[model samples]
Structures are given as structure tokens and as C-alpha cells.
Target: MTERRHDREFVRTFFTSPTAVEGEDDSAKMLRRAADLRGLEAPDVWVPDNEDATAPSMREEGAENVAEVVADSGADFPGEIHPRVVWHRDDPAARYRGFQQMLTVADPDRGAVDHIDGFVIPEVGDIDDWKKADEALTLVETEHGLDRGSLAMSVIVESGEAELAMRHLREEVGKPTNSLERLFLLVDGEVDYTKDMRATTPTGELPPWPELRHNTSRGASAAGLIAVDGPYDDIRDVEGYRERMEANRAKGMTGIWSLTPGQVVEANTAPLPPETGRWLLSAGDRRVELDDRDGAWAYDGDRLSLDETGDDYRLRVGGDERRLDAEQLREELLGLVEYVPSMSDVVDSMEEFEAARESGTGAIAIERAATLRLDGVDVEISSDRMWDEATYQAAMTPIRLFQDVYDHRPDQREELEERYGEDVVERATTVG
Candidate 1:
């Protein structure tokens, strides 16, 4: 059985520091590494391809490690910033009110710090204190100017009231507040809260957080929550990381963080699937519909581009740009036995399979109720494929052109194939 399955599908990641500690500008380079681990890169808006993104430019550990994230995507750093120096509280940018900030990604056209879409901060002292934390968050939600329906916001919950923040996220997002995408709690340290306590009490229980966000939107993820803390959890004692991930999932969380990109495959994928569908696509009479969308293609027959998200590709199966329905989800699980060698890789490869559903547009029965309000059809994606669902989620993570924009360079892709094996992709299907 594949091990690391999840239920929630629609998700994205946000990288930020709890507080901009003294002389800590060099920290944000961690986000760049985070994107790479998931087989992803920063959007073009944050960093253009022509620019040199060598490792040296990264913010090094210093008295104040000022980190910078530059990007490309026609989206400029909303404020003035440079990659060379760290932005401390004294920097004039902190004085402003209600301003959403981005990191300056490297750029060929300019010399200033290139920026990526990131929340800026003068400093933060605690995560558990919503009383004080709410001030910046309220401003962040309103000032972000993000489309309420299509985006997720990361709320750093660590102060004593961190659990309260998580519960608030479940009810407040996509409702009256309509400001959040998911509740990914970033625990700054290995403070043990193993058992549900008064503080780390899970969200959505009898005693819910203040102002529940009852109203949801289309194309939104169910209130998937997560916990990420610990350093090098992979190489050392991964069991603890797994325990935390599963614990959070039990508490209605969707995903967790990995110490390295290599672990992302395992961290994201479920190491197990139901033994019944152990080797075949059918999940107890369900359709395991697999399509060949792996190779380079384009929408409107014009060749896929960095800007365009996706186009309906009518393959052997039905078409609507692309697809990865319940059936395909089943097949990915079934194929795991044939292609996936270990439990960890089985979990890692789940990302590709999950990404397929995002290529096409559909009204999944599970999605109908939680995210899209489409309970019109009956749906059941059994827990048989544990590798597919986040314990807290019941839908699929859609493919975003934001992610498909960049094709891995040949050598790098070859390295992926070498690492995971040719079978990592679909069988008998041609891929890059």
C-alpha cells in the first residue's frame, strides 16, 4: 500500500518568517528551496529566466540575514527593495500601513531587489497571541487585494493561541472574512504538543474558533490544516515528521513540510494504497481513467506557453483541456505497485497524478459539497488509495498554469527519471 495519501486537493504554499528577528534578512532563500523540492519554481513574475539565480545570491546566515525573493510574471515587487541588503524595521518600508509586500527576485531589466509575492513584516514576537497578531492579519487580508475565491493565505500560528488561530481559519476564510486559502501553521520550534492540549486543540471541534467562516467559494479547498516544524526531520528521524503530519491530518490538516526537496515526494505522497487495488487501476468497480498529458503540449493547438494555464486536450479518454478524475486517481494507485519501488517514492509520485485532475475542469462529487457546492452527483473516492488523499481533504489539487509554466530542463528531468526510474511516469506513455 502507498503510505502518504491525503484528502484535500486544492492547495498552494506560502513562505514567510514568524518574525524578522534582528539581522535576519538572509532567511527567505528557504522558500526558493521549498519550491524546488516540490518540483516547482517561483512564478515568472517573481524571477525571470534570463536573470542569473545562482546560489551565491541567496541570503546567508548573518547577524540579520535579510532574505529576498525576486520573481517574473509581470508582477513587480509592489514596493522598492534590493536583494543586496536586508530590510530591517528601520527601513522606511515598515512605516506604511495596509501594504502587501513582495520579495525582489533577480531581474535582468533592473538592479533593485527582484521580488516574489511574499508578505512583508517589520517584526513579529509571538504566534499564539491573536490579540496582537490580528492587527497585522486583518491588514494583510484586506490589503492583499487577492481574488477571494482563488487564493490561500498562510497564517503563522505559534503563539499560545495558535490553535485558536487555526479554528478561526476554518470558519473565517471564504466567509464573512473571505481572506484565507488554507491554515498552514508554522511552528517555529520542536515544542512538543503531541497530545491535543488546551493550546494545540484541533480546529472545528465543539468549541470552534471565533467567527467561523461558513460561507465557502468555488475552486476552493476544504479547510485543510497542517503543522510544519523541526529541522532535517528526513535524514535523521523521519518517523517523528510522519507522526506530526499524520497527527495534524487527524486534526483536519492537509499537508506538512519536509526538511529537504528529496523528501517532498514522500512528505506529499501517501506511502500506502488499499491492498485490493494494489496492482490495477480499478478501485472496486471505479474507473481508473489515465490520460497522456505528461508530454509538452499547448492549449488551442498553439503549443503550451509559460503564460497560458492549460487547454483541453481530447485524448483517448474524454477531454476538457486535461483530466485526472476518480478513475485516474485509482489507476495511479494501482500503478504504484508496478512503478513505485518503496513506500516513500509511492508517496512522492502522488503529486504528478494529483496534478492531472487540475488540468481539466470537472464537478467532482466530493468537491461539489466542500469547495464547489456541486453535490449534484454522488461521489466516493475510497480510502483504499491512502496515498491519494490528505486525511483532512476529500478533493483533488488542480493543475495551475502557474506550476506548468516551466518545463524541467532536459538534464534535470533526466536526473529525475534516474532518481525515480523511467516507470515513474505512466507506462507505455511517452514523456519528455
Candidate 2:
């Protein structure tokens, strides 16, 4: 398996704050504020945006602000820093202007070289365009006597051609001539892509473009890079942002563009496993949260019937009726209601199974039993889930993600310790 790049791990949130705003005494006020963020509000990757977020007239000041603010405060910042630079494949003047801005920020005399990780190039075209961007960064590195391949390059996939160029990444990366190895992230920019495609919608809102997201994930996986979704324009729609993050998570894309610090907090927490466990009961076209009523999982919903047979229990849903034993009833109920495990629940189960495996047991069966009271009808149910080496490894994903978060966000350490408790926080951060 290709290991993830050392500098880029667990990018749950990508925040782009404007670099320089007019009329401010300090042009870098916004960038400085982002650099000072701590706890959950801090993003995994912070971009001092000089491209779209900064006005055309203020871009030069913005670059200077990025260099100055990052140089002054980058050491205290907990997240990775990458400034977005202006670039367009067909526009040479814009590309050179971007190049000049990159050189300005990357200059060792600016005192920001050590603090800067890389640059985010926007409006790239095909593979050649990518190579040109990479070559430009390479030249910038050499111009400053910085180490080759030291500056990472992340691009915004804004056009159809840029999207298609992703297929050549794995192959292009193997060639030793260029600094393709410095490529770190593949971020989607659906707004520009929509414009590029001339796509129209009745709602005047961006299409979900799930296929682009999936393609980005696949390409990132293929190239061993991180894939980030575009910005959620509706900043106040926290729930909507969460729903998109959830869907993106299912597609292997964890990081998303956060428009505000509040959005950053939501994005940061969205990828981690839930803090508490719950059961979600689903029937065709309907779903509801199943509550635990004093040691008995109870349901007060309509359209479900429970009846007792001499030696079995029968459950009728819609038009289907099935007879089941106690364990079978539990399994059936579980099949209908999925359990979303919390961080603690996952850890407990993994440790238990690990102990069993160490005690000479090749596999262990986990029992999940509960008393059901639907419409005041009491029916006891029980089921078993077998766990072995493969299952144990699967359970380690959340633990690994937890460790990554704990490792990267030292600013959030105390909060994490308090939320998960010291013991759990310790085991979670240290466990494989």
C-alpha cells in the first residue's frame, strides 16, 4: 500500500480566509486571526487566500501580508499553511503574476520560507499545465536556494480538462524529471467547473456533481493524495454542510472547503466517529432514531407489529411477516436498525476482541441483546457478531483517525481529553 505523504495526513478541514482586505491598518488582519486559531475552530489546512478571496487590486498586498503574517505567527499556528496563488492556463499574464507572487512569499528574506508548506495553484488546465505549475514552483525553489521538492503544490480542479488530467497523475509521478512528488492535494472547484461546462440549473444552485467527487476520490487514492471538496456557499446552513460532509466521507473524501471558522469546526468534527452510539431504525422510505428505554430498546413508531408464536416471534412490516427465534429476532431487528458506534463503543469492542484473540481464540462472537416494547408489547431479542483478525483490523480505522487528529491538533488536546476522558483519550491517541 502507498503510504500517505508524511506532511499531509488527516486533512478533515480546509479553510480559506481572505488575505488582505482594503481599509485595514494591517492588511493581514484576517490571515493573522486564522493563524491564531486554536481548539476545534482551527482547520487542518489553512490557506491565506490571495486568488478569489482577495480583490484584484489588493493581491500584491495580500501576498506581502501572507509572507509577513505567516513569518510572524506561523510557529504558533497548529495547522499546515498553504497560500493560494492566481493562475489560469490560457492567461499568461495571470500566470506570471501568480509566479511573481509565489516568489515574493517564498523569498527567504521575507522570513516566511520556513513557515510556508507550499502554494495552491488555481485554474489549471491539462497535464502540461500541471507540469508547468510544478516547474514554476521548482524554479521558485531553486531561485531561493530552497531544497528541491520542498514546496508542495496543490491544485484546484476547475475545468473538464483539469479533471481529465488526474488520470495521468500516478504515471506522471513516476518520472524523475519534475517535482510531481511535491503534489499533495486535489481540491474540486465546482463553480468554475460549472461555468466551464456552461451547465445550467433551474434552482440557480450548483449541482451536487457526486460523480466528480467520486472521481476526485478515486484519483487521489490512485495518486496517494488527499481530495478536498469545494466550498459550501451557504455559510449559515450548518446542517446542510454536515450532510454534504457525511456524503463526501462515504466517498472517501474527508476534507472540505470551509467558508468560516464555524464551518471549520463543523468540518473538523464531521469526519471523526460520533461521540455517542445510537440505533437508526429504517423501514422502506422511512427512518427514525430508536431510543433506549431503561435497558429495553423501545419503539413507539407506527407500521410495525410484534406477535408471539409458541416457540418463535413474528414481526410484520408493511406486508411481510417472518417468524424468528429470540436470537433471530435480535438479528432481524439489528438488520432493520443499524448501530452507529461511538469512539468509546468501538474501542471497547476492539479491546474485548483483542483480549479474546490473545487468549488463543481465533474468533469471538459479540452478543447484542435488548428488550423491545413496541405498542406496549414486550419481546426480548438477542444476536451475535463474530469478530476475528480481519474484523479487528477493520475496527482500527476510527482509532487510527483518532490518533491522527490527536497528533495534528495539539491545540485541541485538552478539549479531547475532557470529552473522551483521560483513559480513552490516551488509548485512542496511542493505539494503532
Candidate 3:
């Protein structure tokens, strides 16, 4: 028994290191360790990983990869849920990864907040029709469920569109039915779009630009697009990177895309983790406070912002601190605000979304408009919306049946629980 007590204490050490990344086995060990530390028995099972792990929601893998968690920013907090993920499919538009920035202004007339999920830069390289090559946005409101944002037109100078997107989003904030859940941005140039992308229509802003989040914000924007090709002849080395952050912080380009995984941590961290100054990957669910909305702001595990001054908040991961600007004064400071989603909702949604990919009926189309727009010619559009019709039809058989299954949220909950287990199902919640 005495030895058992020592074993219990040993296990608790890893249970709350506050830096552990949860995986299939890791979470279970954590739960068991936590219980053992307290001389209690862990639940009969371990926590699940991903959507299949829980009721579905709190477990949702954002609408797209590299998403900003709308729920608790804290990865370890009891009530944290990963919100919707989003992204923009790679196209010629992606080439301008760093040079493009969309300033969306909320439509003042709508009197509602137009939360921006992400932005797309048009590939004007050859394709013309603005709409065809333009960026599409996804803005979520509790009412509309999860749908597209209001603006998606191509722009001439990056500055003009950037301003307008902001106006439109803010304008829609006051409307009666608008809770403007803010945004869900997908940042990346991680992957390129190809004719073979016969899966689900690529839904996102850009690819992962872990560097950009570290830049300064124009306002309360969640995700943003920025082009960072400064002729700073100095930014070729590690010191150059740090120097660039200081300079850009002054100008407001937080981070850049031309980054490596190794560089990610240095650009995202505050006090600069001993390992990497970047904190986005290194320190998650850690407490932090940086500048935002003018003065010093705080993110109470739930809402993030400085409605006033001196709000003591915690760093919950997801927010990046590196940038082209503001690297001058290095303070071992704060980080991320958070959001906790419902237990099964996100998981259910993900399962349904995956099933929907099986539907071959919704393919990409090159309408007469697109034909008029394309110059390179060989424009092939698929109705599969990215799903492999043959495979989905082969496995699921009934297309309609599978399509319908994608719409069922509750069923996904059960599926998730049965597959991944309960660790995911029992994450932190803001519902109460």
C-alpha cells in the first residue's frame, strides 16, 4: 500500500505538467494518473482522441485544419472544446500567400458584427472572373448555423478590401438575430489544390501561416491574410527573424508563412519558451496576456479581449505572438484566450462532414461564366465536391443514404462515443 501511494504520486507529476499534448494513449494515462494521484480509481475507460472520442462536439476538429478555437483556448482546461475549422482551397490565389491581406469591414447598415472566418486572395495570374478566383469567407452566427460570411469579392490593392471586410463584419454586429460568433480562420499555403482533390470542396481561408497570427491585429479579428515579403535584407538568420518581429510589430504584420515547424514556436511564444520563443505549439492552455483592442487585454478562459484595462487572463494556446512587427521589447508575458464547445456537437458534426464527403453528387462546375473566365482551357470541374464517388458509393452503396447520414448530428454522437471512447466526451464545457 505504501508503495502504491508512491506510485500514485509519481503518476500525478505527468497528469498536470500543463504542457502535455493529448493523444489516444496520453489522455488515458493522464486520467488514470490524476485518479491515482488522489488515491481514486480512474473511470473504467480512457479519454478518446478526436471526434470519435466523445459526444462529438467538444471534440470537433475545427471546420478546417489550423483553426482558431472559438471555445476555451485552454487545451487542458476542463471545459474546452475545439470550435469549427475552416480553410480556402489552394489555387493560383495561394501564390500571393504573404502579399495578400483582406481587411473586411462589417456592413454598417446591417448593424451586426460580421465575424470573419478567413480570406482568400485571387489568383489573377491568368484566371480573371473575380468571383471564380476570388476569396470566399465563412462567418458563423448561431442563427444561420454555420454558413459563409457576407463578402467575397476580389480586390485591387490589398488595403482596400482589408478595410471593407472589417466594416462589413462590424456593421452586422448589432442586428437582432446576430450573435456574430466572431470568426473561425484557416491559415495556410500548406497544400495546393489539384484536379485530384476529389474529396470535399476545400473549405478554409488560407493554409497554416502560424507566423501571421503573431503579428499585430487591426482589431478584434480572429484570422487574417498577410503578405510578408519585406526587403529586410537582414532577415536571413535567427537574429534576423527576431529583429523582423520587432520591426513588424511596429508595422503590424504578426507572422509569415515561409516558416518551418522548428521556427513556429519562436514566433508564437511570449517570454519565448526556453525551447522556442514561438508559443503557438509549445505552450498551450498556458496563461498569458498581450496587447489587443488598444490597451492591455485579458482572455478569461471563455471570451478574449480587453473590454477595459488590466484584465488578468490566462494563455490557452492558439494565439501566436511572433510577428514582423513588435519584437522590440521582449517580455516573458501571457498568451491565448479560449472556448469550450458542447461535448458531442463538434464530434457529431465532423462525422457527418466526413460522411458528406462520400457524396459524389456535388462536384465542382465550370459554368459558362467559368469558361469565359478561364484562359488555360483544360478546366475540368468535378461534381464530387472532393469526394471519391466510386469509393464512397462502393463502401456505403446508397449515395442518398450516406448523404442523409452526414446530416444527422445526434447519431454522430453515439458513433463517436462507441469508437474513440469518453475522454473526449468529457472535456470542459461552457454550457452550464
lDDT of each: 0.29, 0.87, 0.26
Most accurate candidate by TM-score = 2
lDDT of 3 by residue, 1-432 (tens): 111101011100001111123454342332223222211111111111222122223222212111222111222222112111111224433322211212111222222223222232321221222222232233222133434434322221122223234334344433444323223211212223221222244674333323322321332232232223211222247666665555544443433322322232334321111211111212344444322222222223332221211322222224533321122111222112222223243333333445555564343221111110011111111111232344333323122222222232232344434433455433211111
Write one digit per residue (lDDT tens) for candidate 2, span 110-150: 89989899999999999999999999998899999999889
Ranking by TM-score: 2, 1, 3
Candidate 1 lDDT over residue span 203-322, tens digit each: 522332211111111101234433333223334666655665454444433334343443444443332221111212222334332221232111222221112113321222222133
Task: Kindly give the stretch of ten consecutive residues in candidate 2 with the minimal lDDT sum.
Answer: 1-10
Please identify model 2 stretches exceeding 4 Å from their true place.
303-331, 356-362
TM-score of each: 0.36, 0.93, 0.23
lDDT, candidate 1, equals: 0.29
Q: RMSD in angstroms, all models?
A: 18.4, 2.4, 28.4
TM-score computed on alpha carbons, candidate 2? 0.93
Error of 1 at 104 (Å): 9.1
Once model 3 is optimally superposed onto the true structure by TM-score, how far is the C-alpha of residue 229 displaced, in angstroms?
Answer: 11
